[model samples]
Target: MAVNTVGYTSQITAGFRAVELAHNKKPIIVDHLAQHLAGAALHTALADYQQLQQAQGPGRSLRVPARNRIMDDFVLEALQLLQQQQQQQLDGDGVVQVVHIGCGMDTKPWRLQPLLHVHWFEIDQPAVMQLKQQLLQQAGAATATAPEPGGADLGSTTAGSSTASLAQTAAASDGRSCVAPAAADHEQQQHQQGVRFPLLPQRYSAVPADLAMVPLAACLQAAGFQQQRPTVWVAEALLYYLPLDVACELLRSMRALSGAGSCLAATCIDAELQQAHLRLPSQHYFSTNKVAWHFSMDELAAAIGAAGWRMQGQPQTAAQLARERYGRETYVALYGGAECCFTAVPG
Candidate 1:
């Protein structure tokens, strides 16, 4: 079945990463899996994002690779700390966990290669997770089934051709072709057309859930989450879409599930931007999904703090990080001057 693309924010973000990868001279965060996972949706999403960027002027849009970089760096740093603490305490190579809440087509587990002694859990809406699974399976990223005796290796050659065939069929149906029209050789299209399979690591979990309806703790537990293990909780581009109380409750639940050495790295929105009348480009897309911004930076801090999380430092806005790290200046008004990123640890 063809995946529904309406209000599919995950595909759009994947497109944004792909755009960054293709256009930027030096990308802030390199998401190699972005384009492949995006597949047929890539061109449309790329065009939409490019239009938004042009209208917004200068820097980058909401899902800038630079913003992704901040969260990516935090995850790496958190992992390093978890590993060091494990070594010091003689914890016998305990599983270091990283959970991505609202993990929409994120390629972190694949992109952040060499994640030794670690387990990853990605949670998102059921349909969204389904879409991700389909894309990953199509891209040849999912674990392949074992072949029967005397049969071909289904995971490699056979699977590759089948996927390419599917890609070709889908593109043809849509009046588009994965093969670049300008390219003269059909074989080049065959090689470059389908999404390349990234190095599939040993430990990764995808949990399909509707955070509004299901209990986050229950979902995590079902996915083999260990409460006593060191974890890095990532809530990038989440939080604000929920009601204030619901957002706080979510934070509290994460706190309840957290063990020693667990920390949170999340992107935040300022209360100012959450004002109903504010017309940010991304807000229009979010509004269509029947979700609205609720938590401001201060409100988010308070929520996490009340949930037993303490901020590691002052929350830094995307604009700040972009300027400091990439030397690219952005209009504060673009993102409403919201320092939309921060990290926190258990109090």
Candidate 2:
């Protein structure tokens, strides 16, 4: 079946752009798996990406480096905090769940070491999900017999170390603490349901759903998501594409599905940036990507707060944070405070 990427082509391009930025050795934000995942669909945005890469020169895109730093830092920080919470819960049933809403070609399950123990649910359009599964299977097949790329054996056990070790520790503490058996069984069931990827970590599952059409909470429950556990909802570069009401509804649904201590980490293009794009000549690749920016920083934070999450850190411009985190030497032009990333927890 031909893949339909209608309103989602920008996601593909963003992944490819990140891959190119990584290739240029500009402060790596994405990992090898993410780069590979992005490359899998390079054909979709090859012309535009290549044109931009060549026109701007390698590692010199106007906004990519800053954007990557901001987005990656927010996700990594949130996952680190979530990992700490998961570690504390390890003495109990300690299984943290992560739901990546609109996870198009996302490679976090493999890239983020902490996520190895996470029950990762990647939700996206049916076609995007299917395509990602296909790509993962091919990649998995190629790497099956080889040791995992980053020198960590998938089966290794070390005390309080990696996810594999954490699982071992949990299983040793109590047989019921391990989520693998049930997750493996569920993985098999998902395979039968046509939402499975053979190469993905057993803890990872993909759910095919159009957030614009289906209720997010229902789809998540059908995928075996549990509300009682500590969940981290990631909506990177996702909410802005949605209409204001739909985006707000998604936040509300997430709030309803979350338990106490649940967290949300998200990135968005604010209204000011959207307006700037409109005022400028349509020359940049971003303008042609068809993304809709509907919220100002205050508006986004207010909506999220209304949905029952307490903002964690002060909202900062992507460029400012990127410069602070990575140093000014790697600085690129800021998108005029038009983009921001932040994290929040249940109020």
Candidate 3:
């Protein structure tokens, strides 16, 4: 069956990373968490500022103004939390390994790479990865322009002129390094005569097999994760739809795969979530078969404890973040923070 996903939130991941980069001084793995926050801030601020005309409930009239406030508030809160976490682990081996599970179109790999220079990997369903590759290739092909040399202008074919050519060549080489997709598309169309994209051409090698069947511990071992150093496992807006047993197994896997210093960051739904938490007046909006797992904080904490990991300080709730960080008036009347963040360390 096909999955209905939040195509809008897909881009927010990169924005989250940018927010983290701008606000958090420490380094772990720059994922889209930052950009996500900033977008929330900007968007929520707008909602609050607008004050939508829809009447939601007796006391809950839907308003855009409230949405903006909530988004701004939580983003500020997340950034501060991330900054603290970064500093806590910075002086270590600096061998950061950030694994963005089910990572969408985030640019932490690109932006964070130049700054912290850490090893990063993006994991998702094969199709999503293919999309990423396509998008990246297109971006690479289109924005391949090289910067001009710093000289005022080269005069004559002197030794300096030779240096200019060398500089231009180096710049062009760098531009080619990332390979934007637009350039590739042009080439593909040129060679596109009489050729059609194959249908059902091949089956992918299903590694770790199915999510339901895979032994998490063994799979982690196979992936060289059991003993990897400086690993920070991140599951952004993932893990709600997983069965409770499977979720526990994943926690155990996190413990078994990570060494003493490994950390985990994930987002999950509240245990006692109400329909109001959905926040959208249009009850029929957003796909119903989506990933809001609705696990309680108590249950999640218990699972983490069982897996031999210690909880890090403070919990960040989407709702609490908005009201406290930006002010209650910044968000939409219908929009509330339904998700939250947690970080844990191995015991």
Name the regions of candidate 3 deviating beyond 4 angstroms: 1-94, 113-117, 141-226, 271-287, 290-292, 319-337
- All-Cα superposition RMSD per candidate: 10.7, 9.3, 14.8
In order, candidate lDDTs are 0.65, 0.58, 0.41
lDDT of 2 by residue, 1-347 (tens): 35554324534544555545545555446445544455534554455445656554555433443555566556667666766776776365566777888777666665454334556677778777666656566554221211223432222221113223333433443222224444355345445645433333335446777766767776666555667877888987778767767787888889889976688888776667766755544544345344446666677776777777788888776666766776533322223445677888877
Error of 3 at 283 (Å): 7.2
Worst 10 residues of 1 by lDDT: 175-184
lDDT of 1 by residue, 203-316 (tens): 556666677776878667655566888889999888877777888888889988998889999987767666632555544544524455666888777667777889988988
Model 1, backbone clash pairs (residues 3+ apart or across chains), number: 2
Q: What is candidate 3's lDDT per residue for 243-285, written digit by digit as tens?
A: 6677777777767767544677766655444343444344322
lDDT score of residue 239 within candidate 1: 82
Q: Count steric clashes of candidate 2.
A: 0
TM-score on alpha carbons, each prediction: 0.76, 0.71, 0.52
Better of 2 and 3 by TM-score: 2
Candidate 2: how large is its RMSD?
A: 9.3
lDDT of 1 at 87: 73
